[model samples]
Structure formats: C-alpha cells, structure tokens
Target: MFFDILPRVGLKPKDYILKFILPASVISLLLLILGITYFSGYTRLVVLFLPLLLMGSAIGYPYIELDSQRQKINERLHIFITKFGVLSITDLDRKELMHLLATEKEELGQLATESHKIFVLIKRWNQSLAESCRFLANRSPSSQFGDFLDRMAYSIDSGQELKEFLHGEQDIVMEDYGEFYKRAIYTLDTFKEMYVSAVTSVSFFVTFAIIAPFLLPYDFVTMVTVALLGFVLIEVLLVYAIKSRLPYDRLWHTGEKPTKIDLKLKKWLIISVIGTVLFTLFLLWGKFIGEIPQIMKIPYQIIFALGMSPLAIGGYFAQREENLVIRKEFNFPDFLRSLGDSVSAKGGGMTDSLEYLSSNDFGPLTKDLEGLYKRVSIRVNSQKAWRYFGYDTCSYMIQLFSEMFERCTFLGGNAGVAAHMIGKNFRKIINLRKAKYQSVSQFSGIMYGLAGGMALTLYASAGVANMVNGLYTSLDIPDTMISIVNIITPEDFSLIAYLIYGVLVIYSIVSGYLIKLMDGGHYQVSLMHFVIMLWVASIVGYIAEVMTGSLLGTSLPI
Candidate 1:
C-alpha cells in the first residue's frame, strides 16, 4: 500500500548534507532514503536502504536477473517449440516444453554465473537444443518427433537429406545431452562447497587471532616458527581455493599470452608482504627478549626469500598446465560414444560410418576418429589407424577405444559394448569431480582454522602485555625492574599451552562447516568473513598494547 502511494509523492535525495546540516547523520540519511523510496513509484525502490540496501541488492541481483532472464528465454523457447509444432517437426507439447525449460533453467543457471567459460557452455547448450528442436520438425516429419532434418534443413542447406543419410542420430544426440547436464551438476556442487569452507574458516580464525601473541615468551623460537609456518599454510589454502573455484587455469590464453613474469612478480609481492609482517614481529621479539641472534634470524629470512620465489614460478605454471589439459580433454569421451553409436547404427562399414559422422565435429573426438578412418581408407593397417586414434585422443577413453578397435581390426565386433563401457566410466569421472570438491572443502577448513587460531592468539597475548605493563605502573616499579610475577611465570609463556589447545578446536569447526557447505547449504563466504575475526583481534591487541605501554612507560610492541 505504501509503495503505491509513495511513488506518486515524487520524493528524492539530491544532497544529504543540505538535508542534515541542523540534524544528526542517521536522521538525514533516513529522510534521504525515504524520499528516494517515496519517488520510486515512478522508478525503482532500491535507493531506500542506502548502503545496506545496496549491499543486499548487489548480492541478490544475480539470482533475480538470471531468473528473470530465464523466464524470457523460456518464453522464447516455448514459442520456438510452437513453431516446430506448426511445421510438424516435433510432437513435443506444452508439458514437454515446460520440462525442458525446467531442466535448462537449472542447468544453465548453474553454469552461467561469474565464469565466462561456464557462460559459453550454457549458451552453446541452449543454442544446440534450440537448433535440434527446430530441425527435428523438418528432418523426420513422419516419425512423430518432427520433420527437423529433411524438409527444413535440406531446404536451407540445400544439401542431401542428413536425416536420411545420418539416420538414427536423434536418439544418440538425446543421450549425449543428458550426460552433459550431469557434468554441469557436478561442477555446480563445488560452488556450494566454497561457501561452507568460508564459514568454518572465519570461526576458527577469530579464535586463533585472540590467542597467538601470548605464546611468544614461552619460546620465541617456537612462536616465530609456528607463526611463519602458518603464513605459508594460509598461502597454500589460497591456492586450493582458487583451484576449487575454477576447474581450469586462471589464464585461458583468450588472446595474446600474458607476460608470465608480470604474474610471477605479483605473486612474489603478495608473499613478500606476508613475509615482512611475520619477520618484523619476530625481530621485535628478539630485540625485546634478548633471545634472537643473527645466526637464526638471518638464515630464516633468507630461506623464505629464496623458497617463495620458486613457489611463485612453479605454482603459476602448474595451474596453467592443468587447466589446459582439462580444456583440451573436456567431454571427449562422451562425444566419441555418440559418434561410435551413430556410425554403428547407420548400417555401414566402420570406416564409412566414421567418415560420415566426422562432419558433426562434436569435439576433439571427431577429428581424432576421422584420422583413424582416413588412414584405414587409404589401406593403412588397422594398427596404424588405431595408433593414430590413441596418439591424437587426449581422454582416458583413448587407450580403451583404440585397444577395442585394434583387437577387432575395426570389424565392429562389440564396438557398441566397448563404447558403452567407456561412457559408463566417463560418468564415474563426474563422481571423481564431486569427491575432489569434498577434498577442497576439507582443505579450506584446515587453512581457515589455522589462520583464525593464530590471529586470536596474538590478540590475547597483546592484552596480557597491557595488563602486565599496567601492574608495573600501579606498583611504581622502575623501567628496568623485573617483577617477581613475570619472573616466576610470564603470562605469554603460560598462554602457549592454551593457544595450542585452541588450534584443535579451530580445525574441527572449520572442517565441519566445510562439510556442510560441500554437502549443500546457504552458507556465507567463510574465508572472507573470517578476515573480520582477525580484524577484531588486531584491534583488541592494539588497544591492549597502547594501555600497557602508556602505564608502564614501555614502547608498544608493533
């Protein structure tokens, strides 16, 4: 009711300062937002929440816009299906169209998120489905499916009757589409896992942050060692996160190759920042405690500097290589099964059928198979053709299919059975993908727990320092004086045991949350949110240091 009336009021917020010079900030901001909402009758109501609303909308926009777009695309698909009906292509009715739309909405929506490669896959799927439906009406008009291949496509391409020439390809294509959708689901599962990983990491990070610093005086060597190791461990977690989010390389060779040196430099810069922060903390401990010496400090710093450089280079190359392999081999197994089935069912010789079906160019599978047929047609031995298929096909199915063909001499003896087995194994590959996602979730939890635990520990240690310094002031002790309380039992030294215990709890919570996300849920980003816990700990530590240093006349340890 307010929405209908507010829009007609024509309100707006041109300047908050002008509206609130005499008023408080919140009141002025509220009035400005309300004004915007009031005028939204003629526009959008989005301006009302200010930053909060903006944040909410920003997060919600993907679902809302994608769903809205899906409805429009579904409508277009329905209309396209109707056109097939008019032309007698497919016998699919409204129910069939709705079912297709539902599947496509789920499948495509999952694929069409932030990744451009995924977007391409979805668009191609929709385009192929639309084309197939449209073509079915013209090709096999009398089959009760539609005349998609014969009348319409032949008229357009003015070529031979592909439907007649490539008879029985329809069922194979349908089977392939089902397999494609399955892979899409497996990929989407990883997204859900990431959210869980993020949450677990945050809780653990907060706990860790509050407990770290107190571990220092117990053994600065152990303290620095743990802290430095944790930093490297967190970097490894970052790498794992990147891998889970993207199945392939971060750089896809979209255009000219990017400078590898530049990327390596960027990675090193990040590593350097982490190293600097850690080393500085250790240096402060050595000077204050009169414990750290050049022998240990110099070598530790130098080793990190050298080791991190190679890690940067190796990591970048490994990511690129892995992604390229996936990119080249993606879905080749399924494509081959479809080709093999189409060839066998066409009631022709193996070589002829392979030659005929090669026109589809479904993927790298076709090109490699074409090599086998082309060589054999020229009187190359069966082994030669088989070897070519093995050499060119990058998928695991390559060796399996080549062996099957070579043993039978391409005589089509149980090739269908072998292809079916190959297809079955491909389906299992999807399961492997899901399992890796579970592994990623587990790994993310561990890293989050480690980082959070460290942050929390440092925070608590700072607070203790502040209290100890305050004691010196209250007792009117001199700057150089050593308190009996500290000599007998330093607070930092005692806290080490508790901090170590906290690490175990942090790990469990992190792993549990990641398990939840990977299984599926509306989980928040655990890693990013975990940063907030660290920030809070850092703040508390800073305040503690300031209070203690002021009271006891000691400089605050950074």
Candidate 2:
C-alpha cells in the first residue's frame, strides 16, 4: 500500500517515507487504539514501544545488512586474494578463469556471487572485463568490496598485469582488514562496558520499581511489562553488538553426511525436546491442578530452568563438537604444509604423501587424516575420499581449504605453494577469532556479576517491604495513623517474586547467548553458558530470599 501511495506522497526523504514513516505511522495508530481499549497495564506499556521499535528497525536494517556483509567479505578477503592470485598465475584461458570463479567453493560467498554475476554479464552481453567489473563495483553490497572491484576495473582498463595487480592489492586489503578487525575488537570492548553499566542500571531500576509501589502505587502489571520491555531492548542491543563483530562465513559440508557423532547428537536433540516438553507439561499441570501447591511454590523460573536443562546438556556435546572442529583448524595449516611437502617429495603423488603424513600427529585432525589415507590406500576415488574427510571434520575452515587444495592439485599447480598460502590464510582467521573471544571474556564475567547483584537487590527489596508491613500489622496501628499506600501483601509479594525470577531468567538467557555470539556465531556454544547463568541467577535469588527472610522475620511463601 505504501509502495503504491509513495509517489503521491512526494516525501523528500523517500527512503524514510517508504520504509519507516508509513509503516511506523500505521503501527502507532493501531497500537494507540488497542492501548486505549483492550490493553491495560504492562501490555499497554509494551504496546506504546511498538511503533518506535518498528521505526528503529526500518532505519537500521540496511546499515546492519551492509555492516554484516562487510565483516563477511573481510573474513574471506585473504582467501579470495590467495586463490585468485594462484589461479591468475596459471595458464588457464579467460573462459576457464571465469568458470573457476563461478565454481570455486573456497571464496567468500559475497565475492563469488558477485563474480558469477559479472561473469554472466561478460559472457552473455559480450561486455569487456573492465565494464563488467565497474558494473559490479557500483552495485556491491559492501563498501570494501566495491572499492576492490573499482580497483580491479581501473587496473584492467589500464592494461595492467592482473596477477601483479592482485598480488599488490592483496597486501593493501589485508592491512585495511587488519585495522578493521582491531576496530571491531575495540567496539566489542566498549560494548562490554556498556553491557555492565546498562545491566547495573537496569537492576537498580527494577529494584526501585518493585519497591516504589509501596509509596507511589503504580500499576503492578505495568511495572512488570516495563521491566520486560527494558529486557527486550537490552537483548536487541546485544544482538546488534554480536552481529557487528561476527565473521560472515558460511558453514558447508560435502559428500555423504551423518557420522556416528552426528547420529548420536540427533538422538540427544530429540531427547532434549521430549524432556523439555514433559517437564513443561508437568509444571503446567501442577500450576493449574491446585492439588500440588508446593509445585506452584517452586518458582516458575526454576521450572523453566529445569525444563531447559536437557537442551543445555545436549548443547554441551554440540559445543564440544564445534570446539573440536576449531581445534582441528588450529592444526590444519601445519598439516596442509606437511602434506604439500610430502606430495612434492613424492613427485606430486597425493596417495603416498597422505600415507606418510598419517603417521604424524596433526593434533585433533590426525584421526581424519588417517581415515583419508586408509580410504585412498583401499583404492577409493581420491576426490570422494577427500570430500568424506572434509565432511567428517565438520569444520568450515577444513571444508574451504580442502576444496582449495583439490582445485590447486587438479590444475597441476605447485601443491607446496598452495599449502603455504592456505596455512597462512587459515592462521590469520584463527588468530582473529581467538582475539575476538578474548575481548569478550572479561565482559562475560561482568554479566554474571550483574546477574548476581540483580538477584540480591530483588531479594532485599521484597524482604524489607515484608518486614515493614509485618510491623504495621503487629502494631495494630489505627487506620488514621497510616497514609494510603499500596501495602506489599502476601499476594503482592508472591507476584513480585515471580516477576523478579522472570526478569532474572531473561537477563541470564540474553547475557549468556550474547557472550556466545561474541565468541562465535555458533548457537550451540551458547547453551552451556545459558545453563550456567540460569543456575547462578536461580541459586543467588533463592539464597538471598532465604537469608533476607530469616533476618526480617518474614518468609517467602515458597
């Protein structure tokens, strides 16, 4: 509808009008009506933020996409440069070169896709290489990529040696990428401090919100909803932080899939689902049945934690698998260099070289190498065997380099030089990932500390409120002696405790996943952290409740 009306509107900033203004105006109108009639309290508060959230999302979407693509291209820039340089040194004709670019699996996805488009334009439309590159440069999603393409177009137009240009440009690009990486790391450090400060402030706000009702008498439901909105906002910010820093690499697998470990993990995944469902049903039954008040007394957050436990356990195994792949990558470059040397020593025969290298320890990758060698020894097709090895490792780095090695050797190129290139490139990526993880490590600790503090504050607030209210009851004070205030009654205390638990659970889940995201893009890696944080929050909240209750002569209902 907005697209149709956009021309009639004649908005000066058309992008804003088409994307943000129209959609936000519509949502705001709908939300206002709903807030005025059906929604009350916390729901109304959440409704009020919907239009702002929509506007922000519309404005930020393109920037986020561009930033994400930039990081991805940066991650694979070295690989692209190395592969293109190696291929350039080959004697392949232009057609074959274009074919190679279209088919190459090791190159960055954005670069490969754009190269394929340029290749199509040149082949189908008979456009010159320079023209095709210029077309792509203008349309490139990432600014860095556009700059590279522009440089390539200029070089081609000037009739420069493409190989020499690429070789020189590679260093310059790498230097730029290195600086970008350092800046991203710095941004993450800033995010960490901001996370700590925001969380501390949020905790204080929630505490004050919970306790202030005794004096101010705000709607209880609105307070809870406001707290949830705050949490959602924090989560959104964390997601942005993670996306900004995450490397844009696609995970791929080749050949027949599902190793023994894969099968085992699948079963565990099912078990996790079943366990979560059964526990959740049990909790729901207890809550509704009224027969088991004790079950209801068990904090809902604790129930949620219990229900998610199986998934967390399963996630530990998944995380272990991911880590194993990473560890293999750490040793992969050395293995490639060794294989290259051995192959060169054996007159470029890969079979004997693999046999020779299988005896050598290549760390976590040794087992896979041994398997590859054995398969080849048994007269298995070499490509098939290598693909199997790559798939079995379940590492994106392994898959990429394996394909690169296959391409180099298939073209009768110098395998030793190829090995050296792959090794250095892979090492660079590994080091960057390590640095990224290290940057967030301290912030992760701070998150835990904040969770603990939040729990303590909630506990103290509830306890103190109960203690004061109890004295009011014990004194048998006249109605005239007390001002009109919202008393923290038993029911109110129960509800407030539940709200605190809900917020704490949210905080734990968000912080845990954000930390994992900053460390790596793997969702599985975040599970153990989520489980740990949940436990910390629950334990701390429970402990504080018990201690404060004992001191204040008032016990939590649970």
Candidate 3:
C-alpha cells in the first residue's frame, strides 16, 4: 500500500511512516487538542513545524555517514585502479583466502580451546579479507599456514603436481605478486595522502556541523542548502587545484621514495598562508590599496568567505606527513629478485635467508614482518605466519611480500631469481601507472568541478530564494499577488521556485553515483543522495522565504 504512494510522495512507505505519517499523526492529534490559537498559532509552531524539522534531521544523519563511507571507498578504488594497474581481488575471493587462512586454526585454538576449529574458521572467515590473515599470522604458523599452503599446493594440477608446482612456483609467484604489490603501493601513497586531506576537510565542517546550526536557529533549509552547495563547489575546485598542484606520476620501484609530496606540501602551505595574509591585510588596509565600500559589502564578504574556505582546509592537510606503513612491500620485489639468487646458490635452508628482512629500520610493516620472521626462526614453519602478514598489512606492498616469502620458502629453487624478477615486474607496473595517471588526470578537474560547483549552486540558490521575498514589496505588489501571480507560479512563486529543488535533488543523486560509477564502488549512496536532497530542499526553501518577501513586496514584520 505504501509502495503505491512512494513515487508520488518521493518517499518509501517505511520512510513515510517515520517521516510523514507517524509524527504527522501525532502532531495532528495534538493540533486537534490545541485548536487554532489567536495571534501566532501554537499548532503551526509546536506541532507542525518543529516535528517535521526534527524528523528530517534524524533521517538525514545516517544517510550522511553512509555516503561519507561510500565516497571514501569509491575514491579509494579510483586511486587504487588508476595509480596501480588493474588488479582484481574480490570479497568473493574471501572463501578461497579463508580456506587458506584457517589451515590450522584447530591446533592453535587447542592450545587455547580444543573444540573450536569450525567456529574459529567461521570467525576468521567473516573478518575483512586482509584482517583475516592478520589475525592468523599474528597468531603465527603453528601448523595453520603450512596446512593452508599445503591446501594451496594440493590445488595445483593434481596432488603430487601441486606439491611439485608449489616448489617450482614459489619464486615465480612471489615475483609476480611482488610486481603487483608495487603498483598497489604506488596507488596507496596517493590515497593515504589524499585521505588525510579529506579528513581535514571533514574536520573544517566538524565544528560547524555540530554546534553552529543549533545556536543560530536561523532558517536551516536556507543555510544548509547554501553550505552544502558551497561545500560541493569549493571541494570540486580545491580538489582540482590539489590535483593540479600534485606532481605527475613517476615510476619509481627501487629508487628513493617520492620527495615531491614533502616539497609540494610545504610549497602550497607557504603560498596559501601568504595569500591569506595579503588578502586579509588588503581588506583591512581599506581604501589604502583598493576601493572602499561606502555601500553594501555583504556580497563581497560572502565571495571572500567562499573563496578562502577551501584553502584553509587544504592548508590543514599540507601539514601532516605519514611515511609508508609498509616500506618493505616495495623493497620486497627487489628482495625477491635476490631471493631467486639465494635459492640458486645451492646452500643452507631457504627459510633462514628469507627471515632476514623482518628488521627494525623500517616502519610498522617491518615490525609485522619481523614477527613473521620470528615465527619461522623459532618454529621452523611459516605458512600461517605468512598468511597473517599477507592480510594484516593494508599496503599492497606488504601483502605481496608476505605471499612471496611463503612461496619461495616452499619452492626454494629460484628464490633469488624470483626476487630479481619481482623487482622487474614492479618496474613494469610503475610504468603502467604513469600512463594511467596521465590519462585519468584529464577528468580529475571535471569531476571535482562538477562535485564542488554543483554543491555551491545549492548554497547560492537558497540565498537567491531568500532574496526573492522582497521583490513584491519593491514592485508595490498587492496582497492578492499570491493568487494573481499565475504567470510566475501555479501555487506560489512555484516555477523557478521548485526548479532549484529539482536541480539540487538530481545533482545529489547523480553526483553520488557518478562519484562511484566513474571511479568505482560505494556502499549505499542512494540513502545519502536522499539526505543531501532533503538538506538541499531545506536550503532552497530558506532562500524561498527571502525571495517570497522580495517578490511580494512584503515589509519585514515585527
């Protein structure tokens, strides 16, 4: 029954139940009790107006969180695919990875609990794909890792062939995975840096979003619409500016890390700060440097605020610098090339040579790697340990290296050559990335522009709506203009009035998906699109108030 009303009402039955029906019903009952009071009616004030506003906000917050995560993921996917060459490892692979991950959960759990293998497997299986391995590896090989590899090894051609192939493919697989890892790392670098920038952007709104709205108690729809629109537009341009300021992608597999990020962050910070100071000084300098406003300067103030806001956010990110979480992930390919050499050397156990990397000099990943190394050194096995390392490290570099180490230890023949080949593959992957970035950067501006600019339009239109209210008074229009203004509207100033809402609605929906479709995936953007549209509607409505007064020539009433 509710489904039938969904399209016409622009809401689902369930939503309408919460948004329109439930509260409206409650308010309707209250209104029936209160009756229309003299002077400002309490029904409109306490019953109708406030409840709808609160309902809208409650429904909207979840949508925001959902969209925020969706946006983050889509963006991550875009950078990941573009910066690294295409690589597919789906949640579908979870089953396969899980089987390997739980190779010996029972044995490990027995030291802790005897009757829990199935439960442990299920628990580990449900964890994030990367996390599943982290959980297992942090626990160490015990017997689980070798058991998983033994399972992986068995899957090769046939059981005997699987064993033989595992021995042979160890170096080759490690090298290939290493190459894949490099491309992954290159992409992650940009993502991590941008993520920090994005977080800072979120922070700028953090204070405003929580407190200012409540204290001001101004027309919410008007301000929120403007804020959202401006946010979108500024973000679009700023993202463009940030993208522009970012150096071109360069393939660097074995050389020192990209120094440009450090240099450019500093450079842009200095430039933005200097520009802000000069502009502030110029404004405060008054007629000394420019035209002194003897008239309305509010518009100029608005423009200045809009223009300066993004830079403050940009400057925030330029200050935080995080080195690679997994530097060895990059170095692993090169190390694998050496491993192939070590394997061919015909000397001691392949296990001993591989454990050398888990050292202190590197960052967080090195510690994890050292733990994996420690497992093999102490227990003479690393299957579960390797899997742990593979999944836990978020960086593609670490996962690949962990996988490679497992393979080489099993297939000791080309450990050294495998290492060399892995490095070479990283070089190839890096080259491909350079090509991808150049092609992709072409649209970076367009996406950001569309996103940011459209958002700003949402903001500006509300103010325009507000401005419209005075037109009637200016024109000396009659009180009957609401009925007589058929040329401009059917119900009210309805023509261009609802036009902005339509635009903001479509813009929110399309942008949410466009961000996902063009780049990649988002968890659930639909809900967010709805929230954004609702917020925008409120903004445009506020503008409508001003516009209403202007159009009708209504004087400001006490």
**TM-score order of candidates, top first:** 2, 3, 1
Winner on lDDT between 2 and 3 is: 2
lDDT of model 3 at residue 287?
36
Candidate 1 structure quality by residue, lDDT tens digits, 113-218: 2122223333555533334435433322123223433333344355433223222333343344344334434554554355445444543443343344333344
In angstroms, the error of model 1 at 20 is: 86
TM-score of each: 0.34, 0.80, 0.35
Give the range where candidate 2 is weakest over 10 consecutive residues by summed lDDT. Answer: 2-11
lDDT of 3 by residue, 1-558 (tens): 425424322355577568656776676556644544432565446554655565565545444433333233222221222111111111223244334323423212221221123235546555433333334433322233323334443453243432244344444443443443354445544653553355346434522432243345443345444544554565455445444323222221211232344455556656665775676566545534455774234333232333243344333443232224224345555555554566557564555655654443444456555666676677655676666555444334345444544554453324454454446555554444444444344443343344344434433443343334434334765777544431211233343334434444444444434332322212132223333333444444444444545655441221
RMSD of 3: 16.1
Please provide, for model 2 over 1-558, each residue's C-alpha lDDT reduced to its tens digit, 9 standing for 90 to 100: 334323222223567566677887788788878877898889988987786787777666555666555566676676677777666655675556766787764455656766677788888998887888888777665677779889988998898987678757756776667776777788778777777777777777777776666567576546755875786688678678667665654332433567766777777777777887897788878876754888877765577777777778667787777778778888888999988888877888888889888898888899999999898888747677777888778776687677778777877777887777667767877787787767777777887778888888878877777777676667766777566645555776687777778778777778777876776545665667777788778878878888998887787654
Candidate lDDT (C-alpha), each = 0.41, 0.73, 0.41
Q: What is the lDDT of residue 110 in candidate 1?
A: 22
Winning model by TM-score: 2
Query: Local error of candidate 1 at 167, Å?
Result: 26
- Model 3 regions lying over 4 Å from their true place: 1-328, 346-348, 355-368, 397-401, 411-413, 434-452, 478-482, 486-558
